[model samples]
Target: MDEHPEPGHDPAVGALDPRAELSEFLRTRRARLKPEDVGLRSFGRYRRVPGLRREELAQLAGVSAAYYTRLEQGNGRHVSAEVLDAIARALRLSDAEHAHLTHLAKPKQHKKKPAVRTQQVSGPLRTLLDTMDGVPASIVGRRSDILAWNRMAAAVFGNWAELPAQEQNWVRLVFLRPEYRDLFADWERKANDVVCQLRLDAGSHPHDPQLSALVGELSVKSEDFRRLWATRDVTVKCNGVQRLHHPLVGELDLRVESFHLADDHEQMLLTSHAEPGSPSAEALRLLASWGTDATTAGAGTPPTRTA
Candidate 1:
């Protein structure tokens, strides 16, 4: 990755321009829906646009084309909730997408000053992570930064503790590091999930400079990141399954769960574990015995015990 910012990048802090973001998001959403998909007839033989036209979408949403056009142009300062709901229905948006639209249209008032403090893991949370013996767990802060991680997490995901503070981000690790690209069995799917989660975060906190900077950096460095970020997908990370190819362990399918911290919603406790009595479970057992050294163990190293 280049240490210098890409040419034309603002030297100040990074932030998604709300108006531009809203316009692009609405355009993409509208482009994904066809007239037939929404039970509308195609009146013309050769449609100029990819999906439904602006007027057609406005008609479907039960609003004037002028009003819808204004909204789509990112002038949603006076847009009503009922109208937004109608538009969301017309676009066939998911719950997450609907929320993202709402956030874009009706952004919260931010403080005059920008946030600068770094997130920290509390001592109690650190203790909790340490006590979660066999589970691979980590506390992730904004931009998927690995704030704190346990021994199992180090063994499974590599030692984040050894990385520089700014380099301990999931996006950075997954896109910038070749090892992580090989680590995930389904690299494309995992990349989409990571970008979607970041999109959701971007919508919720559009004024976050650090997040904007992270996005800018990734966009400059990784073509895959640039492609995925443009999709405008949004999703809340609750639970999922990830297949990993650990260097020490051959292959492991782990259930991934994320729980947002009650007091600090910006932070989440992420854990990955395998099923009981499975080969993956046995693999975890072996890694636990090897401890943090499992990260340094070469992929070709002979297994001390059979799974």
Candidate 2:
């Protein structure tokens, strides 16, 4: 709403950072590969294009020249399953990269409302989360839906069961409510991680309507979300340390271990306590006491954590 603005931003602030990042990444990745890598030949001619010429790649992938060009140009929105597989093969992509490529090329499904997806952890995973008693562990969905957790996790994350269902989303908590800033000791770092993981999820599960809706909501509600979403940095989030300021524990320094679910589009998250005999550990001990037997009866809570 102001006439004066920062560099690369208009009065409206139209262009986003994510798009630039995505385009650059694609260009850089493609540029590194040669014809022999994908089972093609250069014919000993000095190539006009830096990478596999756009047309050559399209031919190898069994796609139209126009379509591949559109995709590389970042103009195309939706791509079919067949084309995705073909491109994956042509690019000589690894398993992880192939999965990521599919996520990017596909379009996110449209949903009326961002209802949470049900992806419960197995008995083993639940037991594992319980076994690591000192850790603050939680299973989440593509849109940061807090699914299930251990006692410390429950305490560290403000007792999810006591909160409203719609308020369970991490993005919702971070942007919609001011409480999150106080919850994390290093709020800015946590905020970046949240958005980056969300961006990766967006790339991986393009058909997830729930995720799309949450992004739409976040982009509308928070300018920070809008700016970060524009970055387009896709990465598989696994391990990280978090400094948490919890309601009961005060503060905690914890280490995180994230395991991907087998073909379920979910993840098993375990945030283990880093220090023993420290204030954080004592707080975790208190949190465990809070979830002692007969305190609150509960069953499994399942949500996909595609990190």
Candidate 3:
């Protein structure tokens, strides 16, 4: 027998139990719906259940009440794609939420042992980042690790290079770093979006210990994170506007875009841009100038005299 077990053989990995996740997801989704929301009649009789009853959901989804109950109890076996789709429709899941449901319901079968998670930045990708002089850009890994960044990104989001590798997480910076928290004009909304994104990631990668640990730590430390996580929201990153309060340059309203790497689905390239001739564009120009001056000053400074 091999003395050392595989990486994901730990108790925590086993404890993740995707069946339980599926059950919880279904329950939460069902709880959020009301009778009228789904075109069902609600009598004046006081109901004990918070949301739609199991029978009601079953009827709506065109499934047997017993089967739906078993599914909700985590006893569902060989559930069909048709059934899953019906349930998703019954729950009125958004695209992101529906995807999360599919992930939890039918996890990928690993024919071989899972490879170790890595965040390697390709040479070509690094070269591409260097070419983006004015646009703020960063490459983020599966767990929101800041893999690499351009100079403009460093200027806008603070230099991730100065922080320890383990501290390069987006979730950690959002909740723990005061400067990062204050940077967003819509802090609460942004925080909720981030948590939702993390939840979606968790559903897809249930056995990822690093992700689990990050969630556990944040739950213990941040009340806001805990509250938002309980909502079981899921959202895919998309183009949006980010209103920032830059320390040196004042206000900046930049358009944010997230692109998934074609070679690595787990990696994302995020970039921010401002409309040409706008105040935000001018602020970006000023920021670039300041960064250039700082670089020049540092290069010209004399080396410290060491003992």
Candidate 4:
């Protein structure tokens, strides 16, 4: 008998469960559709299940019912791209959803774990953060780890230098930290977006141990994280607005922008700023002044973690 398990078989306890992910994605997508929504006439008969039947969906997508069933059952080893695309079209998946479907269907090639858990920020990137004196900015690694941050970023967001390196994860802060939860005006919306972004990241880097651990940790600790994760939503972080209740600066609105570093695609530069001459901008100025004073006062002093 072959010693190795099947291609999509669940490996060790902490490894990525690709088959389970595929199964969940297909099932959730299937459950969200109705007969009428896809132009199929409902005969006013009582339906035993929600959404379109598997056979019905298979017919619409021009695939064999048995094949579609296997796909949903997590046996879709080496599933063709053409078939995935056809099914995506049938389901009317959005651009993000379509990309996510592709990711779920095709797992990344297995690789050895890296010795270093975190990627380092480049010197030029560090200089850029320093140059942007007023704007709050930080460099984030692929796994949502805060690689580095400027004084303004440390002032606006919590102090990254104070947190233990492993604990400086954006997703962890949002879900696990009470102060962060209270900082966002639209906490629910922010939470959903962060979880969705992490889902997208997981799809892209399935074999990443650090990513898996973070997901496992959040899943175990937060019911809200687990529920949001199950929805299988995917979003590429680009631009957004953050309404923050800063402890020292009062309420301020900041525009959040994320830029993928050309030198290193796996890392991104994230910044938040307010419109010039706006009240929020003035608040940011005050924040800058306070940050400067705080830095001078604490010069040569070690950073302390904020509660």
Error (Å) of candidate 4 at residue 225 is 0.8
Over 4 Å off, model 1: 1-13, 43-45, 300-307
User: Per-residue CA lDDT of candidate 2, range 1-307, in tens?
Assistant: 2122222222243322333334544565566678777777876567766777777878988889898888876666757778878876887666655666665555445665244466666788778778776567777765677777877666566667777887787878887778788878877676777787776675655445666667656666677776665544445555777788665446777777776666566665646666778776776666666663312322333222222
Cα lDDT tens digits, model 4, 214-249, are: 777677677778778878777775588889987666
Tens digits of per-residue lDDT, candidate 1, 75-154, equal 76778899999999999999999999998899888667567567999999999999999899999887878899999998
User: Which residue window of length 10 is worst by lDDT in model 4?
Assistant: 1-10
Model 2 TM: 0.61
Question: Which candidate number maximizes lDDT?
Answer: 1
RMSD of candidate 4 to true structure, Å: 6.3
lDDT of each: 0.85, 0.64, 0.81, 0.79
In angstroms, what RMSD does candidate 2 have relative to the true structure? 9.9
Which residue runs does candidate 4 get wrong by more than 4 Å? 1-12, 43-45, 111-118, 292-307
**Best candidate, TM-score-wise?**
1
Error of 2 at 41 (Å): 28
lDDT of 3 by residue, 1-307 (tens): 1223112223333335567668878898999899989998876468788789999999999999999999988888888889999999999999899999888888777887467577799999999998999999999887678899999998788877778999998889998788777789988878887788888888888777787777766766677776777677888865799999876667999999999999898889999999999999998877787774322222244223222
lDDT of 1 at 117: 64
